[model samples]
Target: MTSPRMIQIASGKGGVGKTWLSVTLAEALAAMHRDVLLFDGDLGLANVDVHLGLVPTLDLGSVIAGRARIEEAITTYEIPSVSGAAGGVKFDVLAGKSGSGVLSALTRTEIAGIARALSRLSERYAHVVIDLAAGLDQSVMALCTPDSTTLVVVTDEPTSLTDAYAFIKLLTLQDAEADIRVIVNFANDREHAWRTHAALTNACKTFLGIAPPLAGFVPRDNLVRDAIRRQTPILFRHPQAKASEAVRKLARDLLVPLPKSTPGPVLRRGA
Candidate 1:
């Protein structure tokens, strides 16, 4: 069996719609008939459950504390059919404990154990999308592996671009061959999106000598805020929304098969 394709959605700062993208992206992949597991890697302030309106009894914290097995902590989410589509989409989620700094305080070895567990869990799914916490922190870095496709979410704001550059630079320093890509969120238009991507790419090419391609861009839409407010995935609530269509296109683009050979996990150091 082909190993699951690991995808890590990351960002330099908060409030860039990283979590929203993660949730909708997972749903989009599921809509495409791929079995996906959306793991909330944001250990400290996890809210994937909140975004999806899920009240999971067991979470990653339970698994980490040995109170529950990793598989037992998974909560399945289903989206019923809308717009005459056939069977609706379904995906699994491994939620994180919110308002508790305990998981964030885990040592490197403990993080490694979680990583190994995720590696084992990957065997049963076609894709595993990890929503990493914002900023350059130990928890975020430890979960990033060289084999995963890292999508750095950025906007046109100056701080967003600067922090994203710092993140890509640091990740490159850690793994020179890291598969880094960019996603421009809240873009005003296609021109604006390309401009944002070029700015970040120019900075990386000039300073880091590497230009990560733009995987895709999500346009700014008021409906997106509405979906989030309702605690429903935009793709299901507003399938025809511009942002939803963009994410669906992204899912189709990423559906291209990866290489046959799989690499062993290479977890990065927190420090």
Candidate 2:
């Protein structure tokens, strides 16, 4: 069996629409008839469920506490038909708990256990999207792995740029060869996005000796806000929105076609 391509979406600062992009990207890929698994790595402040307007009784915290198996903590969302498809898309979501410092309090053993469980789950899907917590905390850095693709989401603000650089610097120190990508969010236009990407790419090249390529940019659109308020993904609620179109294009460009599964044992829960 082939392993899933794990993409970790991280932001140096909070409220930069990391969760929104993660969920929307998952929807976009699932719409392409690719199996996807969305993991809310924002641990204590998991907002993926809120963005999807779902109230999950179990989350990653539950599994970490040994109250439920990893499979039991997984939730499913039936994406309504789009593109005139006859059937809907089915994707798995592993939610996060909402409690102050709940995730931060987890021990190293507990964190490693979760990572191992995620690795096991990845085998069943073509892509695994992990919405990691913001900043350069140990908890956030612990999730970085050689096999995972890390996306650093940044905005036009100076603070956002500085903090994003700090996060990338810290990550490279740990794994210099890590597969990293950049996504400029809230850009005014293509030129604006290019400027922001250039600034970040140049700094990394000069200082860290590494430059992650720009995957794409997501424009500042009002439809994104509306979808958030209504607990719907813009990709599903308004596919015509500029932000949604960009996300769909980005997913298509970044995610590769799944390799043919070899003749071997594979475990799929809730298939």
Question: What are the Cα lDDT values of the candidates?
Answer: 0.86, 0.81
Please provide, for model 1 over 97-151, each residue's C-alpha lDDT reduced to its tens digit, 9 standing for 90 to 100: 9768789899878887788899899889989999999989878888887677888
Candidate 2 local lDDT, 12-53, one digit each (tens): 898888999999989988888888999988765878888887
User: Candidate 1's error at 225, in angstroms?
Assistant: 0.5
Quality of model 2 by C-alpha lDDT: 0.81
C-alpha RMSD values across all candidates? 6.0, 7.3
Clashing pairs in 2: none
How far residue 262's Cα lies from its native spot in candidate 2, in Å, is 26
Clashing pairs in 1: none
| Reference-based TM-score of each model | 0.91, 0.89
